[model samples]
Target chain A: MEENEMRRVDLVVIGGSAGSFTVLLEILPKIRTDIDFAIVVVLHRKNNFTTSIADVFDQKCALPVLECEDKDRIEKGKIYFAPADYHLLIEKDSCFSLDYSEKVNFSRPAIDITFKNAADVYQSKLVGILLSGANADGAEGLAYIKQKSGTTIVQDPESAEIATMPNEALKLCKPDFIANVGEIADLINQF
Target chain B: MRIYTLVDDDDLETLLNDVANKYGYDFTEYSKASMKRRVNRLCTLDKFASFAELRYRVLNNDSYFARFVEEVTVNVTEMFRDQHFYKTLRDEIIPQLGVHSHIKIWLAGCSTGEEAYSLSILLHEANLAHKAIIYATDINPRVLETARNGIYPIHLIRGYSQNYINSGGITDFSDYYTANYDYARFVDKLREHMIFATHNLVSDSSFNEFQLILCRNVLIYFDKNLQDKVFNLFDASLENLGYLALGSKETIKFSHLERRYQQIGKEKIWRKMK
Candidate 1:
């Protein structure tokens, strides 16, 4: 693979837990609404919280955001959020599957499970981003995407409200890029 | 615009049909994407060199095919899962159902009997246990046997207990189960009111009519067509105005039978108003 060659992508998957809402608020609304790739976000929250996070994201982002349902078709230029209490997975057909299988990383919508499945489906034609979180959930998943030759990015730890997630991913994958909130917004907009 | 095919969909479809013809167990209506993933996983787990070898083993060996059936079905469930549904069952559905002198509830795809046992606990608390007869059925006989035993790992009980408390449980969660070593055995009294049976949602017809039916998380594995077939089966089995509970993520909104049912308290629990 050439160093300067741009990787073609059909989807962008971003994972965060704990302190990620603020980072998303900063980055999502700024991304160019016309970008071609689909975006999926997995954020961990309390089990009892009934508020729709996708509705919140929809308010802040230029792109339409939705809570993923089982067997939902994945389309270009849309954003999908893992519904609470379900593990959002991507199938070979490129549709979504919400699994009630036991929690991984003590989270139902675990980042690892989603990222690994995304890597299997997208291979090199995907971009995985790990943002601010308190747990080590997304580290191994980000590494998986990197091993599959997909682009991987970690929020520069200094900019992450909680640095554990980004730092752990950085340690595991030594990802393709490290950028803060604003630069990540720019990087994604370029696609 | 190109889709990768590690195993071609048509070949897998043929393999599934062979298993059905040989064993009388059907897999035709299941969602292909997830089913393909599950089949691929079975191949890797059993170290089968190819799908053709898997097909041969499934045709020639009965025990191997049984193992294949277990691997393909999804058995993810917990006692009082989706606390809100259980809470609604206690606060609204059960109270209205109390008017009936004898109640029959069918729990379709009742994997491992957690949901069945959860319902029994609710009935016992509501003082309706004597009148309630719950039928807990699943496609996997192995899980139905475990469901009949009513024993769960002690570690998992803590989570169930928390869910129980969250669902407005009035008694101590430990009162329902006796813990010994690493396993918790639910009381025999709760088990007495329930009957566990083996019924495949894909191939089997409804065995009886019921006042309440629960088919949670099971239909998500099926394709849209299969889901509608199961929905028709549920509509046929459910007594008019009977309660139906689905998994939190499962929906009847897109099914042909959607107009026949009315959403109850939560979107997941519905009533067959028509």
Candidate 2:
């Protein structure tokens, strides 16, 4: 894809597991509040009766943060975290849908499910970022984003807290950029 | 390898229309994202080769259509899911309902009877089992059969036990069921006040008025219009001051019935005011 022909990005999906919390804590606080696209974060988590990840992110992030609910309409300049124990999907009309179907790759909020769904909805206007994790959940989805001519970024495995996730993603498809957490934050600000 | 797309949007529309027109099971109002995923998964699981093949099998074969309905509507559920919600029911809701001479509770979308059994245990513990009658309903009859059996995998018992404890349950959770081989069959006494049946929230009318209605994690699969229709059905069926519960992420706040119901505490349970 040529730089001159790049489509206007409308959605950014970030997938991580294992040691990705520190990365998100560092990156979320740095995200500008005025970005034009909506952001969704998909992280592997246990089903807890209390204390959602969104509540924690809302305190530190510049933009409004929320846990994604069923049929929630996507909005610009906000961040949504996929709720635990359910696969979060993007409908064609840009609303969110939650599913309790069997987990993929031993995960409910599987990065690949959200990534592929978002890719189908946003097509060339999507950006998918895979960060530090111990599993291969996000690799195929990132690769799918690349196949759809959307922007793909993998955290530099050497700099990641755990390299397995990013390394697996790198093995699947060539991402547009491979950078550390700080560099990834900088790239997102430019979007 | 590219993730295959055997079923596209147009294909899904045609399939849903055919099923509704021929079979009267309308899935046109289901959330398309989940529906599409389930349909694609069915294709992969059944090895249909193509979307047209799957459509032909569904449209022509009654047994295959039954399988299709089972696959498309999600039935995954657990006992005492979201411990706090059950805790609220145990500490607050049950005590309030116990004051009534008899309790009628409707468990809509009660898949596999986990929740129905859980409610039975709560009522039994509160000494209200004799006065309570649970109407458990689902769109799929196969799951209703499972619910009626009161048998579940033994491995799930550990989690259910833990959730029961977390939900303020004090009695021996193990006493509720007897483990045989890989399955745990719940005591017959727990199944006494329960009635399991096939009830489609989409097209079915309410059969009885109730003091409490619990339909959790089911509405997420529906679109706004269908949700409103179901809510109206609930509104019509609920008695005055009866409680209506939804999934934790779901709400009645934005709907037309918002003004008629008041949310109790932070839980998704609401009380009808008018």
Candidate 3:
């Protein structure tokens, strides 16, 4: 709930499902307040509306928080959350898309779709971070990022709030770094 | 010599993959069965004694892969292939389309430009050609260049003419083109409002939204998973209430997002639901 300063992330993709909020809280305070890039957080949700995620994320992070919009431009130093009921896609030109037209992995805002598209456009510049979740949605997407020459990080399964998602990702593509909450944020600030 | 005999599915896949990587023409992600049949046929027709022999010949012959791709996924479309769909477009959609000064239509997977030229001809008949923009796209560059040429075997003209008559031709079909020995040259004006480019409907996202989208015949070859992926892309690239037409055998039913569309009927027309 404290104010530090504005920081930019060139592009950060965070994936989680079962217990991601705790992970977010641990990492938010450690990111440098001076960086300038966009951060996209894809957290799984039921078909119901996502009313409180912005409010919750806003309290723990220094950056302004809001759900992404279709055709919305990604600007630096803003924390954009994937709105429920849509899979967020990054265009070739680095704009965002809210595609509710289909569901992948039985979840809208499916992690794989966003990660793959983001990797395609950003390539080696992409940083895909997978956190704790109950499902396998982020596995293929993380693999896509590594295959496309992007950097990857995942929450260490031993210390995760829920280890299923990060563990699934390890089976698919071994990430460049696996760390606990304290170290995860420490590394993100390095970027 | 009887080469290509040990060419099982895996062998066929590897050979095709090698061909694609060496020649820069990708068939790796295409329908497995279709690719299999084509590789088998190409080897048989070219007369190789074994898979090794076939791979050797293919590695040395980049042109063979070029023609192989052309033969496997070639549009094989003639003018007005579906008369009833054309009739529905004219009688139903056009009347309700209102008088827009310019119309933009995307013909996704528009192999060799048959459907693009057909639509152009229809717009010309309706006095809408000068205001129409038809962006026809295919993944194969060779096919795109062929489409740019706008020439077809004169023999195919007879069938196209028949399809034209079946679809309610108002004027003689020959009015659209001139017979030049073995090939027919379509009127240059038909190509004026048209742009043919290489686009992969499967791997590429929809770049621009259009008032109408015609992607027929091609989806039948894709698996259900890929089909659903592409249908979603089409949904994004169509304007609100924009028309989406699929092939006769194709439907939005059972897809992950079928409820977003309103089907026109057995006519193969669909509209984005607001």
DockQ numbers for every candidate? Answer: 0.31, 0.76, 0.01
lDDT of every predicted structure (CA atoms): 0.86, 0.93, 0.75
- Give the C-alpha miss distance for residue B219 in model 3, angstroms: 1.1
lDDT of 3 by residue, B1-274 (tens): 1112246667967976786678665565554444454566566677767888878866876677566666566355667866779998877776555466668899987877888888888888887887779999987778888788889999888988998888887999899998988999899999999988888775677888788999876765554557678888988888888899886546677775578778886677988886
Query: What tens-digit string does per-residue lDDT give for candidate 1 at B59-130?
Result: 898888789888888787899987778898999998888999999999999988898899999999999999
Tens digits of per-residue lDDT for model 3 on A79-181?
8888765567665556564443235788777898778767767778788999988889988889888887788888999988778889889998878888888
lDDT tens digits by residue: candidate 2, A1-191: 45565569899999999989999999999999889999999999778736889989999987999999888899999999999998999988888989887889899899999998888888889999999999899999999998888899999999999999999999989999998999999888877
**CA lDDT of B160 in candidate 1?**
96
Best by DockQ: 2
Give the C-alpha interface root-mean-square deviation per candidate. 6.8, 1.3, 14.9
For candidate 2 chain B, the 10 contiguous residues with the lowest summed lDDT are B1-10
**Which ten residues in a row are the worst by lDDT in model 1 chain B?**
B1-10
> What is the alpha-carbon lDDT of model 2 when measured against the actual structure?
0.93
